[model samples]
Target: MTAGQVSNNGPKPLQRNLSRRVSFNEATLARSQEPPKPPAEPEFIDTEAQVVSRPPYSACCNSCCAWTSLVLAVLLLLSILVGGVYFAFLQSNLPQVRLHRLDVYYLEVNNTDTDTFLTSDLEVRLNFTNDNSKIKLSYSRMTASLTAEGVDLGTVTVPAITQEPSSSADVRARTWMRKTSAEEAVAEDLRDNSLKHLMVIDVVLKGHIDFLVNGNKMNGFPIKVSCRSIDQSEIDNGHAPKCGVQMTPL
Candidate 1:
């Protein structure tokens, strides 16, 4: 080939390569300037689908706890209401008791060098009244104690008694003080009072009582009856003193 023809062929191949490089650079530049394609629209991810679901047992447990709390609250309210009603019923329907009579059989006092000997016999009568129209009262065996001037004279057993609704009952107890000793001063006072027929004595009765309401027997409770300052003159004058009755607290 001639020298001019070879140079021309070489320059045409170089021009073709240059043109291809320019086309590739323009395509890259165009892609870089095209508003970045809005970051490919974030791949259309759903946030709710990605979140972890709660366990079924957890919801069930919460519901159960709520129901339990509600039930307990209801039970507490019912208990309070029932307690209030029971207390009211108790306050309105209490039994009535009193002393009916007192009797002195004999009293004797003897003096010695060191102490004084005393012997006495006495009887006590108590009246129990049940004012409740629908309830009955049953008393257990009781003990009666006799005291003269803060000195225990004797103790005796009293028989149990039952009273129907709106009815009254009486209990009698007899006590004998045998060969009891006392101080000289106390014996002198007792002897002087006995001679003058003006002796005073106190009686205390302790027992348990049960109530029957609507054919149901209730639990028993302790009871105390006190008859204080029973004078012989008052008994002679046909006056029956009223006694004080106390029961265990509910």
Candidate 2:
């Protein structure tokens, strides 16, 4: 009925509403300042709790599942790409060395009518060249020897005369093994014993190749001249026996 009483009663509803609004605003502000949420709580429905699931999924839940699947797929793809990149990077650092091809030839001599060809006891020619344009050859002496029907004639080093990159030139190397007239007679007798008891000849050669052996270029592939002795009668018939040598190119 009085002025103060009327004023107090008139503002009571507005004051209560204002206070409620202020409390709500304060709660919203506190939520903003709070640390990030600890992710959503997983919903697990007990099978025993009689609950019916519809055929069509809830739209919100379907959208969340789809988003989760997309994120996992992206992560998987990123991991695979990173692994592939790492493998390629590792492969580039590995060493890749190649070898060159080498060829060897054999020449047989039994009887010679010309005296000019009697300079050496036995001569063997060989070739070492790079068939690939990208590869180069690095080697040491070529050691070759002779064998007659599983017999050791001898072994010697093949000297290198010249090397021209244009056409792989022949080294024209020679090997000598001393043989006396008595030795010749014995060899002839042995040959006469059996025609099929043919002689076996082998030439073994090796040298320092481009590859490092124990951290040295002087150690590489071993040379081998394993060939059969050509027919001596062919040489007596006025024809040279075929040279039996192999090629090795680095």
How accurate locally, in lDDT, is each candidate? 0.78, 0.47
TM-score computed on alpha carbons, candidate 2: 0.34
Work out the TM-score per prediction: 0.63, 0.34
Candidate with maximal TM-score: 1
Sliding window of 10 residues with minimal summed lDDT for model 2: 94-103
Which ranges in model 2 have alpha carbons more than 4 Å from their true place? Answer: 1-120, 160-167, 179-186, 189-200, 211-219, 229-250
Per-residue lDDT tens digits for candidate 2, residues 1-250, read 8999998799889999999999999999999999997989889878655445445578998999999999999999999999789555333321222111121222222443422111124454444443333323444666666555554556666653323222253444445544322244445544452243333334455443343223433234333334345444433344433333232332
Model 1: per-residue Cα lDDT over 55-168, one tens digit each:
456788999999999999999999999988976666455566666566767777887777788888878777777898898888886888988766677898888888899998
lDDT of 2 at 109: 27
Q: Residue 236 of candidate 1: its Cα lDDT? A: 62
Count clashing pairs, candidate 1: 0
